[model samples]
Target: MRVKGEIDAYEVMAVNPYKALIVPRMVSGFLITPILTLIGTFTGILGGYIITVMVQGSNAWGFMGNLFNWLDMTDILGGIIKAAFFGILVILISCYYGFHVRGGAAGVGQATNDAVVASVVSIMVMNYFLTTAFFGFNI
Candidate 1:
């Protein structure tokens, strides 16, 4: 929309573009990331159960037993925390790049690349610290 002039049009019409466009996206990111993480975690566990019990012929009870023994609320909460932060980081960084975009289509391409790279780097850095904070120094 910024590239296509819609954002400017909105601004000209007395709408705050940031509030109109960015806030909803940031809010959605903040809310949706944890939900998606929970869904993915559940799906992964289910898939593991299927593969272990059905394909590998493992005892279903034993598999479930080990799952409960190894996984806990803390692990799930840590994952959700990390995912929520990562989502916010990605959205904020992308919005910042997008808001500052210039030079037309070429600018959009460069900004997009920069946003992705920055987001990945930010996520990796945040993941390390978040893990350390949650699980402590294990080395």
Candidate 2:
């Protein structure tokens, strides 16, 4: 919309661009990431079951039995927490870059590229700290 002057039209109507634009995305990312992570976790377990029990002919009972032993609530919660943080980081960074876009389509492309790079780098750095905090600094 910034490229097309839609945002300017919104401002002429006294609409708050940040609220209309960034907040929804931030909220959506904060809420949806955990949900998607949960779904992915279940699907991953199911896939593991398919591979181990069905494909490899391992005992289904054993797989099911040891699953809880190997995977705990802490691990799952940690993943969900990580997903939430990562989602927020990605959305906020993208929004920042997007809002600051200048020039034209080329600027949008550049902002997008920069946002992806920044998001990835920040996520990696944040992951290390989060993991250390969650699991503790053993070293």
Candidate 3:
């Protein structure tokens, strides 16, 4: 949402809401979302590492090293591939609900709420199916 009459990075970067599949909204989302996802992944990894270190206590580095060693180039590639779909999910959900902000504060508020809710749900659902298809890892 724009504040102080200032358009967001998304607003400036997003394409006109109607064009093709890879429009500005999608492009911006694709660019920025991986960073957010990486933060979440790293935070989760750190928490798990700390817990393993404390609970297991004997071999924290060894465990983490082994887990990370499994994350080869193909694993990173798969993650990047998944992130692209997540970005697509976010942009489509947001733009689906948020294109008509000119409808006023109430409309904008509802749209923002819907955007967040839809993005989250879409990501969760898409992640499950995509991960299942790509790695057969049923999350």
Candidate 4:
């Protein structure tokens, strides 16, 4: 926890201030949230396309066509950028809570359980707030 002391939980797996800071900071980026966010984005887009095709049926082409048409380079790029931020948030929260999950075998289980719940909740909350902030009720 940076806010509290300096455990460097997953950082170095050692003890060196310089290498610890630099290495850990870099490695921390790809921890959990970012990966989950990317996964969520892929699945979310797939789900959207699937539902559009399935529900729209005869109009699926039109739907997909319009969807792709509206999504210009900026929109797509914005999505990737936003996803990266969301991923960071999710990972930070998860790592914050899960970094200290320790005890024994049972503690490991608890850590995993907490990590999953935190990750999902973090994603959902971020998704809602981000969507609202970006598009809100206008869309």
**How close is every model to the real structure, measured as TM-score?**
0.90, 0.90, 0.66, 0.56
lDDT of each: 0.93, 0.93, 0.73, 0.64
Q: Is candidate 2 or candidate 4 better by TM-score?
A: 2
How far out, in Å, is residue 96 in model 3? 2.6
RMSD of 3: 5.8
Query: What ranking of all candidate models by TM-score puts the best one first?
Result: 2, 1, 3, 4
- Tens-digit lDDT string for candidate 2 (55-80): 99999999998997798889899999
Write the residue-wise lDDT of candidate 4 on 113-138 in tens digits: 88788878877877778777766657
Task: Go through the candidates in order and give the C-alpha RMSD of each one to the true structure.
Answer: 1.8, 1.7, 5.8, 6.1
Model 1 misplaced stretches (Cα beyond 4 Å) = 137-139
lDDT of 3 by residue, 6-74 (tens): 344445677432553337778888877777767777888888888888876858779778987787776
- Which residue pairs clash in candidate 1? none
Q: Write model 1 residue lDDT over 49-113, tens digit each, in one string.
A: 99989999999999999889998999999999889998888999999999989888999999999
Model 1 deviation from native, Cα RMSD in Å: 1.8
lDDT of 1 at 135: 81
**Candidate 4 segments exceeding 4 Å error:** 1-64, 137-139
Query: Which scores higher on TM-score, 2 or 3?
Result: 2
Query: Measured by TM-score, how close is model 2 to the native structure?
Result: 0.90
**Candidate 1 Cα lDDT to native:** 0.93
